[model samples]
Target: MTVLVSGGSKCGKSRYAEDIISKSGIDKKYYIATMQPFGEEAHLAIERHRKMREGKGFLTLEQYTDIEKAEISLQSAVLIECMGNLCANEMFSDSAVEDPVSKIVSGIKKLSERAGLLVIVTNEVFSDGIEYESGTMEYIKAMGEINSRISAFADVVTECVYGIPVAVKGDV
Candidate 1:
């Protein structure tokens, strides 16, 4: 089953995703962390996430981009922490790829096929309605499009709002 869990920043979406995957009855759980710590805030956020999963039976694989090439590849259940970071990393990576969204979507599909359950956490990009620079707007557009595509691929789609999950598609 492919589950897409999405929400705004600090909305507890990751926790919800983790909970779902942990109870999936899959013996091997892999956390595919896609974030790259670039600053103090990001480092702290990474630490917080690490602490959150301290005791959990999650073998984390840091695959910033090109997930298909990850060493572990997949497991009984895989939780992709977030799509925002992966998309950004792919878009700005040294080996530039056209249509980063499509590339990542394909990677997600590959993971889904390889795992018994695939839980993906993504970010909500259009809520603010704030105008960004051209590059930022492009990124937002990609995220919106990618989220929709992932939703179609997912068996269950949910959005976390204020730490509460709002069922957007299918059931939890």
Candidate 2:
């Protein structure tokens, strides 16, 4: 099953997605940590997540980009902690900025095929009425496009509102 869970920051989307994978009864559980811990805040968040999964029997794979390239067994259940960071890494590279919609979408599709159960967590960053700068707007638009494409192919699409999982496309 392919599940996509999306919501605002700190809304329990990551925990919810983890639960989905943990309860699936799959022996090989993998947590694909997509965030590149570049600074103090990112480091702290990563540590917190590590503590959360300390005893969950999950093998953490830190793949900042090209998720399709991550090696995994066919019987494994994978939880991708988020798309926002992944997208940013793909978009604003070290030398240049590029559109990441197709690359991210394609990579995720390939990952879904390889894993027994795939749960993807994404952020809800579009609801705010304020307009952003050109670069930020590009990111928002790219995220929307990528999410739409993934949600179309996902078996379950859930939105976490105030830590409550609400089904957007399929049962949570």
Candidate 3:
């Protein structure tokens, strides 16, 4: 089964995704950490997430990009902590990878092929209704497109609002 959990920051989407994946009855749970720590805030957030998953029995795979190449058991359940960071890393990275959407979607498909259950966490973007710079706008557009594509194929699509999950598609 594939699930997409999305919402604003601190909306409890990550916790919800973790809870569902942990109870999935899959013995091998893999947490694919996609965040790339670049600054103090990033480091602190990474530490916080590490602490959260300390006892969750997840073998962490720090794949900032190219998630399809991540090595894991075929029967393992995979939880991709987020798409925002992954997208940013791919878009603004030193590499010459073109079209972040295609790259990410391909990786997701590959992971789905390899894992038993795939749970993806993404942030809700373009909700502020404020004009951003060209580069930022490009990112927002990319995220919106990526989320739409994922939701289309995901078995479950949920929006976490104030720790409450409002189902947008199939049930989790």
Q: Which candidate is the best by TM-score?
A: 3
Cα RMSD for candidate 1?
A: 1.3
lDDT of 3 by residue, 14-39 (tens): 99999889889899999999998889
Ranking under TM-score, best-scoring first?
3, 2, 1
Q: TM-score of predicted model 2?
A: 0.96
Off by over 4 Å in 2: 95-98
Q: What's the TM-score of each model vs. the native?
A: 0.95, 0.96, 0.97
- Count of backbone clashes, every candidate in sequence: 0, 0, 0
lDDT (10s digit) by residue, model 1, range 1-172: 9999999989999999999987888888888899997899889988999999888888989999998765544458888988999998998879869879889888888888988889999999887989999999999999998899889878999999999999999986
lDDT of 2 by residue, 4-110 (tens): 99999899998899899889999999999999888999999999999988899999898988877888889699999889998888888783435478878988999
Cα lDDT of candidate 2 equals 0.90
- For model 3, the run of ten residues with the poorest summed lDDT: 106-115
Q: After superposition, how far is residue 126 of candidate 2 from its true place, in Å?
A: 0.3
Winning candidate number (lDDT): 3
Q: List runs of model 1 lying over 4 Å from the truth.
A: 72-75
Error of 2 at 145 (Å): 0.5
lDDT of each: 0.88, 0.90, 0.90
Q: What ordering of candidates by lDDT runs from best to worst?
A: 3, 2, 1
Report clash pairs, candidate 3: none
What C-alpha lDDT, on a 0 to 100 scale, does residue 29 get in candidate 3?
Answer: 94
